[model samples]
Target chain A: MISIDKYAYNSRLRRRDPMQKLVFAMMTLSVCIWAEKIIISIAVIFIMGGMTVLKGGTPFPFFLRLLLVPMIFLLVGVFTIAVNICENQEMLLWAIPFAGKWIGFSDASLVKSLKLFLRALGAVSCLYFLSLNTPMVDLLAAFRRLGMPKVFVELMELVYRFIFSLMETADTIYNAQNCRLGYSSLCSSYRSLAIMASMLFIKSYKQSKALYTALEARGYEGEINVLEEAYESHWGWYIMAVAVNALLVLFVIALKSITGGLS
Target chain B: MNENILETKDLHYIYADGAVALKGISIGIKKGKCTAVLGANGAGKSTMFLNFNGIYRPSSGQVLFNGKPIDYSRKGLKELRRKIGMVFQDPDNQLFSASVFQDISFGVVNMKLPEKECRRRVDNAMEQIGITHLRDKPTHSLSFGQKKRVAIAGVLAMEPEVLVLDEPTAGLDPIGVSELMKMLRQIQTTLGITVVISTHDIDIVPLYCDYVFVMYHGMMVLEGTPKQVFTQKETIRDINLRLPRIGHLMEILKYKDDFDLDDSINTISEARIALKDWKARYLKR
Candidate 1:
């Protein structure tokens, strides 16, 4: 995982400005939400997946990881609707007597649940495609260029740095505990975790002071200086992204038209 | 007697928890000389170096740079700091920039140098430390030795007249230590910058320091040439530091011969030759 972040990969999608990817992600998500057609959502997912594969990298594991998160949400929605079938007021396609009431399942409810699940999956997939292709630093730089306040951007950078520093401290504490056989037994491991937490807090406080001193020595006068660059969105890539979004939009319009025509 | 680039007059500092770190310490750091502050842990060597760069304002007394007292004004301190570059003990703390190039250019950028000038200085400093290849690399990816070199490059880019280092070789392997020492010596000699080093390594004093100050119990106990201080075995031992290797070997030789010998040999080769010459003279007598 660390190596993936460290080494630069070749991808046209990766080279595009993060702001562009962010916009594309939002557009795809909104289209997925509005369009009730599963076919259109599936088409959008296929296009994003194709881009991942064509980037000449094995993104299958990352894709699986991304998919697993949304799968949980989909399962939750399915189970919630499945368990509360008793009070549902529609024509029953299936019914089972439970606790003195006819626990009924309807075709419309099932279809609604499945639609919500697919919409969520489509949205998550779009976000995964955007994040997996873009480096975080460049993304943050893009945010800075998007006219975000300097203080907020600097705070974000500092927070990112602090997370890594905390991780290092945690690693050191874990190693020290391991060396002392603190984790040899389950009881000892619990005790070690508590002690490590306290130690980590103290160490982090000291490190924060050291970091401040270091920053002051380097002439940090209350604000971090960030270089600004204009994100030139390529017309071709922008058009392609828009076209992908427009397909989903048109599908929604078609769905609305069909529903209206049926009514 | 020389112009004191940095002078601390009875500087005393106590931590917020009331632990006295520096007690009535006075020292004159001259320009264009490598002056080492030698002491053991808790002897207040680091406290003194912090004072040199205004990292710690003394609880009492004054810190003067170029005959002017350091004002509490932020602008004054920043200007003073620009003239006194500090290389911290941990390179990890010092080189925190995302990339090596940004880390090296940090002080330059802080000094508000022109973009082209900053780039030029960063390139020159990296070239000096032989780390130009690491320019675009993230700092977190570099090895400890490389990080130390980058930290030094960061400070060197500032082009300060006085360089203050606190245990620059601490936690370093022998090669890293040697590489750091070579770089420090080169910088001091070529640029004629005032180099103030605080270290626990006694052997480094004779080899690199033009003047040495021995600190004990939060005070500067002895100050003189390395030769003068190292010969005082009791004082060196009191500070929990060993005599330099050559001085230790000379002590052993003194028992065998009644001839006068200097206890200030700085290198192994010098000690070897001196031992051979002394033995030859003793045999003749």
Candidate 2:
């Protein structure tokens, strides 16, 4: 998660308007889910991955690794859908006899599971493209512009800002405990872990109070208002996004007409 | 003899848990002059600073800004904070935003200035702190010194009449300390903002401050120019504080070594000039 944040900050498209990236990612994600075709899903995955790596400057290996993170869950879910029980063995592509019924996967279920897996992957890739290229700060600014609830946005901003420091504090405590041999034994390890957790909680509480006082000193009148950063936004990016999504929709329509069904 | 811009009249603060932090503290922060509040840990320095911005209302007595008692009304505090910006010790606590540009602009934006003016101030603050290169960097990625600069820039953007910092030199490297103090002195001199800093770093007090106040056990033990305050060596050491290194070295030379050196010198340049004068007198002898 931290590495992804680092990449997002260093992304080549970081200077591009976050709203543009957000709209493109959401539009493509909707298209990928709506056009429930194996070919279209695969195409969406490639397009999103290509944009994130080639355009956003994330390494190809890292992108591939990130894509594999969901593969375990996807495979487990797809496995459940691939196996079925039926009364007629004739409907089964592969079957095993079980208590007078056949338990197996049919050709239809196999195709359905494969399509579902690709569709989910395609949807996830769209989100990855967005996150890999846009930092959380930029996203929050975009959220503010889009009329997101002020309370929700403020909470998110504060959480995002402190997460790194909280992690550092956790790391420091862990090291300090290790130095004191607090984790030398399993029994002590549990004790040390509990102590660290309580310490972190107390420290965070104090830190929150300090943050509030500091904010009040700066005239924070119940709002975490800040000037939004200016980006090199152009209508050309929005036009390109709409045109690409329209092309995908058109291709899906042409495929439906040609195959005459949910191809 | 500048008039006081901010003053506390016999101010007292007691925490909700029945702990007294400040006891009848009265001090005047001269306008357009740099002031230092020196104290050991838990000497009520931070408590006093919080009261300066009305973050902590005094239990007894009052805090005055521009010769008027600070109005505790919401609108009045909003107006007062605009003129008395504060930079906290822990940059992580003060910098609520991840982006340097946004964090610097937070105080300026809260002033409700025009958009263009806010942008200009933020840019100028970044430039003043030499953190323009860090403007795009996230707060978490910055070094501790860089984060300190960003925190200062955040407050400096408001263009406050009096900039109060609590422990500004703590946890900084030697070079970081000097550079930060230099920048602060420049801000105080060039912009004429009354700078007040609370720190136990004795070395910087003589170098950067025009006036000093020493606190002990929730009370003001001493207040004067650095030269006058450092002269009470026993009082300073009794309160768990010490003179600057040069001052200590000069004391050893004058008393223990029986050298004709001025033990009153606290800073390096002063010690050097004093030693040059002693050398000239010895040559005449």
Candidate 3:
């Protein structure tokens, strides 16, 4: 039932040399960071979102789900700041006056907190795009091409692979336990957890040895080469990407300048 | 006679926790023959298979590849391992690369082959396994059968002399098992690569293997052709194993006087034909 085409999209991104994507990401990120005005941040977010939707076939619902986490944090920050305003403030919105201003609110502080929340949201949105749209393999490959230390890239690859593998092993152990009726009570669940952990340790140890053997069998001599052929972006695609990003960067600068002038 | 490409000399292995996995096992794997190692759970079939590529160094014994003892030194082990590719029991363990193409190319890249040659081998391996269409697909999303095929392709890309598989057909549905057996048979015939597989599936051995090794308690208890091994009902019973269903049915037919049939029916289809012929003769009478 699995569609190969759906999975192929990730590799297609990988084909777009990691180095180019990294450069593109850095350029976009730097602009996002420097743009102080909310309008500019919102503009960059919308632009990036549109492009991701086009390239990744990602839906609005997917973006909504990703934003849900940061949205909660933003709400919490807003609520905390709104509830814990300092006393002796001019034009206080509300005051509990419990034990001398334990809880109060001020319009000025509220506006300032809202601005901070917006900035945080903007940063989070940019990160979500980068992490979700860009394949991790391509990112690591780009890092390697950028002259990052081999050991660092290797460590990253191993760590990423290990997380997925460990999860799979855990799932298998859980299934095996379920089949054996290993968990019927709270005590049994605790026992199952311990057993699962021990089994994972043993299995991981064995797999490490087996993996090394498999690697050696393939003529591995310390160097791990991925069979990724880097493709240069078409001039048209490069220009489009660069032009769009450059325009956003310039727009952010212009918006910031306007905000400064107005202030 | 073909030369012995791999041999184990009293190879012994114990787990870190002191469980003896293999105990003084000695066997020579002949080149270009499909050897099936059959054993029950905890019979050390896997431990013995792991020794082929020096995954586990024997406690006191030795493994020799091409008549040279496998040394634990990095260079020596790497050289020995490169010639004997293994597909683990779990396809998930073997197919860890992000995409099918990357998984297949992993061994080739490890070999440090030229990029063009590596691509050619990856293409060829995928084609051989009929998974060329899955090249760009993420391996995690594949079915168990598809993942197993990808695992085999990964090993095939390495072009090792011996392909050691641990329980290749385990956990597969009937159709998947047959399909995998068919693929393994094709690879053996077309590539002429030596294959050593460990499995509890006695049913598959008669159909695919040229020789069988039955292990029990960390030692090989029986070794022979499938015909020879399956005909020994007592030995199979001693090891807590059963004969193939066809063999069992053949024995039952011999016990019944009304069914006059040859005692040598070795496969289910042959048994079916024998039953049909008996029915026809009896109905005529």
TM-score of each: 0.83, 0.97, 0.85
Judging by lDDT against the true structure, name the best candidate: 2
Cα RMSD (angstroms) for every candidate in the order listed: 4.1, 1.6, 4.1
Best by DockQ: 2
Candidate 2 residue lDDT tens string, A146-253 = 999999999999999999999999999999999999999999999999999999999999999999999988888898899998887999999988998899999999
The lowest-lDDT stretch of 10 consecutive residues in candidate 3 chain B is B257-266
Can you give the DockQ of every candidate in the order shown?
0.27, 0.86, 0.45
Worst 10 residues of 1 chain B by lDDT: B253-262
lDDT values, one for every candidate: 0.78, 0.94, 0.76
Model 3 ranges with Cα > 4 A deviation: A1-15, A78-111, A169-206, A220-223, A229-232, A235-238, A252-262, B1-3, B8-28, B57-76, B256-258, B276-285
Clashing pairs in 1: none
Highest TM-score: give the candidate number: 2
The digit string of per-residue lDDT tens for model 2 on B48-119 reads 999988899999988999999999999999989999989999998999998999999999999999999999
Candidate 1's error at B198, in angstroms? 1.3
| Pairs in clash, predicted candidate 2 | none
- At residue B174, candidate 2 shows an lDDT of 97
Please write out the lDDT profile of model 1 over residues A1-263, one tens digit for every residue. Answer: 45345432234455566787777777887787777667767876776666665662536666667578669768987767754455544466787777766676677667767777777777777766766666555566777778899778777766655566678779988999999999999999999999999998888778778877977887878776633223446777677779988876876687768788231
Off by over 4 Å in 1: A1-16, A50-59, A82-110, A178-191, A226-240, A247-263, B95-105, B133-142, B253-263, B272-285
Off by over 4 Å in 2: A86-90, A95-103, B283-285
Worst 10 residues of 3 chain A by lDDT: A1-10
